[model samples]
Target chain A: MTYDWTLWIVFILIGLATTLPRGSFIILGERASLPEGLQKALRYAPAAALAAIVVPDVVLVGGVVEVLNPKLAAAFAAVLATQVSRNPWLPFIVGMGVLLGLRHFL
Target chain B: MSPSFREGAREGFRVFLPLSVGLIPWALVTGMTMGGVGFTPLQAMGMNVIVFAGTAQLGTLPLIAAGSPVWLIVVTAFVLNLRFIIFSAALARGFHGVPRAERWLAGHLLTDGVFATCLEKMLSHEDPRWRLGYYLAPSLWSWLLWQVFAFCGVMAAGSIPKSWSLEFMATIALIVLLVPMARLRPMLLAALTGGTLAVLLRGMPLRLGVIVAIIGGIAAGFAAERWQGAAR
Candidate 1:
């Protein structure tokens, strides 16, 4: 397919928008503090945002909501690993292994 | 310089190692999605090099597939990535003492996972360079893995089965990573609020509901923290 300049432009703009905030703050360097309330809120934002994104995706399959999907099961396994070991790598590897194995069986 | 250039480079490599595993699947999925959407391997690789953000790239792929207006796709992607504004602000505070050049370079490497990991490390270690080390180590790994795995996906695009449910794997990976971080009540509240709001608002057009869910979650978290502080 031929290149679309518009798509390229959009991609660049999106990239810019994404990077700007991170860069701007670093470049600006301590001119201000995040409002205390917002700072506190920021702490939770990632976990919340990530959970919001991940939960539904893992639970829903083929228009049916089932948390028992292999993906969710693997995720639960990973969570358990994380809780027990607190080792980031172990849980990920174990989860991936479980998912890969289940994928084969299913 | 807050961290010697050598130190920064070392930090970056260290950050890159552990994160490579998690990023591999994500990057592979992204490349596969891009290729499935009909992007050439070159285009997909270029996107990885330049855009570098996973969700925004994934978000824009559908628009490209649908032959949507380029400007609209770009705008939507920009909107989707607005979260970095908060991340940037937080990081700016932490790296305030660093020189402009170093700060700018670090900013280029800033990412959600990196920022979160770095912030947590900084909370425990007072030395800014140590925090930089912690942040750069995983982040560098993630970046390299994303590029390599994405390239593999793009090259083997047709061979990769759609049934693999790689996206599902990515979601599971994120959930696994996030569970360890949700240690506080405010954090828990935010997660619950965001998840509920996202489901409630899932039907909204243009994925605006996701944004709303994010804002709601953040607000709820802030409120919870404030209330707890007041109680204390």
Candidate 2:
């Protein structure tokens, strides 16, 4: 298959842009501190963004909310695993197991 | 184990273990899906190793499969990963004394999970070395597992069936991981704002909705913090 230079360029640009933020603050050193308020905001950004992505996906399947969806069931299992194991991997596994198992039933 | 190596290994292990659990299925699915879409195992693995961000990688898969322009794929991935900038800066503060080589290594290891775990550890611990280890441990595990799963998924691409329900499961996994972090009011606000904006703007092309959501969340969070500080 022919390699797409356009894709390669796009990927490189993306890589640079993605790396810039992470690298910028490091490169900047102590020249400036992130604004105190902005710092506070950053704390919640991940969770909120993630929730936005996850909630709808779990609750709404095929443009309809299905309370009995296995995805939600596995998600519940993951929450349990996270609480019980206090380990990140466990919840993910439990969730995956729930998903696979439920796949058979669905 | 010497203290240094022991710390490194421990840090590596913490990141490696749990991350493996989440990554295995995700990577496998990615690989399998890539194959289903016509990418070879080597190509899929290459993407995993090279791109290294799960969401962005997944986001670009369909585009790649559809023979979308390379620039579009790269641009989409870049926008999705812009948050790492904030994470890296926050982490750099904690690793001021780390050598350049170690810093680079740490950068490679840095991801959402490692950043969160390390941030918690840094807040609680004073030992730089231990802090480093604590941060590194889970990230290392996550990284290693991602590679293993990606490779396995690519190899077994044909065997793994696609289930739309599993997609929901993935979202749930992300939600479970995110809930504990929404502690502060500003954080809650940021999450709410970002998420709402994302949904509202989901129709925008090239995943620009995510970018808008991020900006909205950050701005809301900043305003909330400033207001709280003034009130105090």
Q: Considering every candidate listed, which one attains the maximal lDDT?
A: 1
Stretches of candidate 1 off by over 4 Å are: A1-10, A30-33, A61-71, A84-106, B1-40, B54-103, B111-146, B149-159
User: Candidate 2 residues A1-106, lDDT tens each?
Assistant: 3344454455556556455555655545555567754555556556555655655555556746678987778777877786677665577567878877987877
How well is each residue in B106-162 modelled by candidate 2, as lDDT tens digits? 665567766765675555666657766766667667778888887876777556565
Superposition TM-score, candidate 2 onto the true structure: 0.63
lDDT of 2 at B48: 71
Residue-wise C-alpha lDDT for candidate 1, range A1-106, written one tens digit per residue:
4466555666677778667766776777767556665556556656666766665556667635776777777887878887888554566567767887897999
Alpha-carbon shift of residue B106 in model 1 (angstroms): 3.2
lDDT of 1 by residue, B8-121 (tens): 547656655565565666676677767766676777788888888886677566556656555556654564555676777766666745567767667767777787656754
Residue B101 of model 2 has an lDDT of: 66
TM-score of chain B of each: 0.64, 0.66
